[model samples]
Target: MNDTATPLLDVRDLCVRYETSGASSWRRHLTTVLRDVTFRIGAGETYGLVGESGSGKSTTGRAILRLADIGGGAITFDGQDVATMGRRTPLAYRRDVQAVYQDPGASLNPRHHVGRAVTDALRRHGLGSAAERRARAEEVFVQVGLTADHLTRYPSEMSGGQLQRVAIARALVLNPRLIVCDEAVSALDLSTQSQIINLLMDVQEQTGVSYLFITHDLGVVRHVSHRVGVLRAGELVEQGETKALFEAPLHEYTRSLIAASPASHPQGRDERRAARQARRRAGVGAA
Candidate 1:
């Protein structure tokens, strides 16, 4: 963990609800997506949120980014309440917090050059003149392992890894203090996933930025996160320092997630499988 007295992002008893139509337009019900979920991320640290599909992992990220409505509790970033920021989110807040989603291709527009993603953000925040924006875009591209020539290419022209790099570049161009990376590397191959993970860690080392890395990959979480929180059915089931939590998970759900994650090596695959079977037979099913 960061060991800092004050965390960069603090989420306290956070609750999120969504209004869904029932049988008809007049019949609607509010579903609680997140319940009293609480966690903290220190500056320059990575906090991994892990869960299976429909476990509220992405919903929590959306709440932090102010894309989802908060039914109760609070999200404090840099000591400011995000939910109370009013209907119009401040430009400074937009500049301070950014997101990198799972599908980079969908997040980008195919009609415009990939460089436009970064340049448009700069233009929105009034960061610099056109010339400066282009220059800055080129700078961030290089920072993310892409060359200036990439600025002229459209999304269709680049590979998956390249598109993801562009997405990271777009988030980095703003010089945000915190990044909400929702399944950022889940779509890539193992090799490319490792590369992007290292790239993110390197960027954090250099820039002192924090990351809310939300993913179901326990292996990735162990490799990158300083601390981790396990979410199950819209609630936090376990949370602690990465090493301690993984080695000695107090919650049965956490143990199941760790067991379900494919081992990095195949040496003890059978033994691990047998153990999992035994656990399941003993009434501790995998989550």
Candidate 2:
């Protein structure tokens, strides 16, 4: 919405690599995971990063959070460089830039009550007394469309959707400026995913928090993203307004991705069947 101001998060020429080793000496090689990726997310904007698995989409999110070791590039948050943050400074950064992972079941501690998990950040940051943290935790729970009473339950006791709402509450408890939603809805069923996506957008609208929403689902991306960026093998081949890009994808890879989405069209199913039949006929003739 506010296009005049500086971006809340800026990433420039980010590159990441991993080392692989063979059985013999001197056989090791470096595999590039992300290559010269650049993007910016303004305050309250949802920037969707969509790609197939192993496309380095998740790695990019981790790199912004400093979970991955970067080979090169600059990641700046609110004009300050995040990659160069000192050990203790990252704690502060964590407060401002939180994350909700794909699996809330895994992200939450089964041993702890959901209330404690939500309040942990407030406690660790020394924001308030135990009673204050508890009260604030309940407020966030309500904000994320959960009853404060649910906070008494453990992660395992809650359904997948309920657990995810709690996970979102944990992120909201911190009042973060940017939340890296790394496939945050992918694990849920379609109806639940829709609920989560709507909740995320609602939260963003209310709090003005930005999201770096990473997912393999182009249809979901189209629904939630203000802008879309398509990554192939770590390279951001196309980035544009979501509607424009989806209506007329510029890149071949981007077009293929949209076409491959099973939700794209009913006609696509017939086309696929026809293609399969054609392939079979061609094989028979060749034989």
Candidate 3:
């Protein structure tokens, strides 16, 4: 939120391409998944990437985390070009920029106990000895609203929400500065989703971490984001302060996205939002 400070993550003109088979039997060509996408997540700020399914939101997250190839552009984090980070610095980068994936079930190793999986990353980073790391892992469990004792349990034993809590705990164990939460609560029930959202806010509050929250749910973005960027067909159509964008959308694509959202003001849509904006303007007029 500091105005004079540099951004925590800056991505410029990023592009990604995925190869798909052609109709003709023996041919393939690259399909662009993200097209000249650019954005920034500031220190201790939540930047929401809003879009529908297959809008390349996930691809952007994967590319930022180095899980996918970057066919073009540059991503810089903490003043270092992440793409140029060699073998010696990758582990360090991984420690600073962590990810909470969409499917916790698939992301977590089924064979490992939840506690072990969380601790493995901490140990790999050489944060602590066995005893210290175990204790740290337990502390993170309670931080994410999970009992320390559940560390012994395997991923297969937990529900989707619980598995996500474990995943969160794992990410927290490393004490990351920035986290890419990719549909982290999409699989949970509404009540459970609220719990996770609160947990993420609390974690950000206490740890001074920022989140790149990618979701198709505008309602969720409205609740959690400081600023929102709408992506359509691999390109960012519009972005601004969340309230400003919600109240007065300049782009038709953004308005369409707001319309498509299920939880948006259903019947009145633009009318209600416009009324609120009018009131604010009238209040300023009086002042």
Candidate 4:
């Protein structure tokens, strides 16, 4: 869908399942989490995957990060079959693909200095000497709007926004081609969320990196994504360019989601509320 010469990430008919415990230990059932999920992200592009809870949005990101087992289909990254990659993922791939989770504080160890998060990643990849790694860490910290001095502080010493910036620096230090942002901004306040979203866009413009942004916040998706995908019950119900999808969604589920998203301004609050009430009375998208 990106129409790039070659997409940075391509997922086709991806299927993921997990075995659930049944009535007895000897009996188990396989529950499919993703079914025929497909999408593509190009270099420097942001693809927003949006859905409510249990919609398989995060599962898709996990599959791409190689943290989840793929039950079927193919995931090709930069022309390589990621799904077929053996249990031991390549170090190059590890460096090329990184993740920034929702809880930045939890992502960093409470015992270690915040700087260690970036330095440790560099050390694992054998990128540079200790001095070089430290310097690189400082540079990326500044890039994410944090001072080099802040790196010496512990996670508990910083605010949520600051911690999130540190997490972004850690992911950026690897110079990754793509980053899976799993609800990366959902934990922050409105102002902080806007700042982080802008920071990500600036970083992409400067680095040509791709993003697979998985979140339940449609407002954030509309603000940050170039393209959007709506997932329901482990399947993609609709996907298209951001403007078109938001303005004229084709699928019933997609329309319902858009209608349910809080309006950006107060100008049409009463009108929108009345429309929702009408839809509810008609038994449309009822909970």
* lDDT (tens digit, per residue) of candidate 1 on 1-287: 55557988999999999999998889999999999999999999899999999999999999888889999999999999999986689998898899999999997889999999999999988888999999999999999999999999999999999999999999999999999999999999988887788788779878999999999989888878889999999999999998789889999999999998986422122344466688899999732
lDDT of 3 by residue, 46-152 (tens): 99998988999999998888888888999999888976654345787889888897788886778888899888988898888999999999999998888988999
- Give the C-alpha lDDT of model 2: 0.87
What's the lDDT for residue 147 in model 2?
91
Off by over 4 Å in 4: 1-4, 265-287
Q: Which tens-of-lDDT digit does each residue in 55-124 have in candidate 2?
A: 9999999898888888898899999998787444567788998899988888677798988888887989
Candidates sorted on lDDT, descending = 4, 1, 2, 3
TM-score preference between candidates 1 and 4, better one: 4
What's the lDDT of the predicted structure labeled candidate 4? 0.90
Over 4 Å off, model 1: 2-4, 264-287
- Cα displacement (Å) at residue 128, model 4: 0.6
After the best TM-score superposition of candidate 2, give how far the Cα of residue 42 lies from its true spot, in angstroms.
Answer: 0.4
Which residue pairs in candidate 1 collide? none
Which lDDT tens digits does candidate 4 get at residues 1-287? 44747898999999999999999999999999999998999988899999999999999999999999999999999999999886799999999999999999987899999999999999999989999999999999999999999989999999999999999999999999999999999999988988888789779878999999999988888877889999999999999998799889999999999999996422122344466688899989621
TM-score of 3: 0.87
* Predicted structure 2, TM vs. truth: 0.88
Q: What overall lDDT, based on C-alpha atoms, would model 1 receive against the true structure?
A: 0.90
Ranking by TM-score: 4, 1, 2, 3
What Cα-based lDDT does every candidate model obtain? Answer: 0.90, 0.87, 0.85, 0.90
Could you say which candidate leads in TM-score? 4
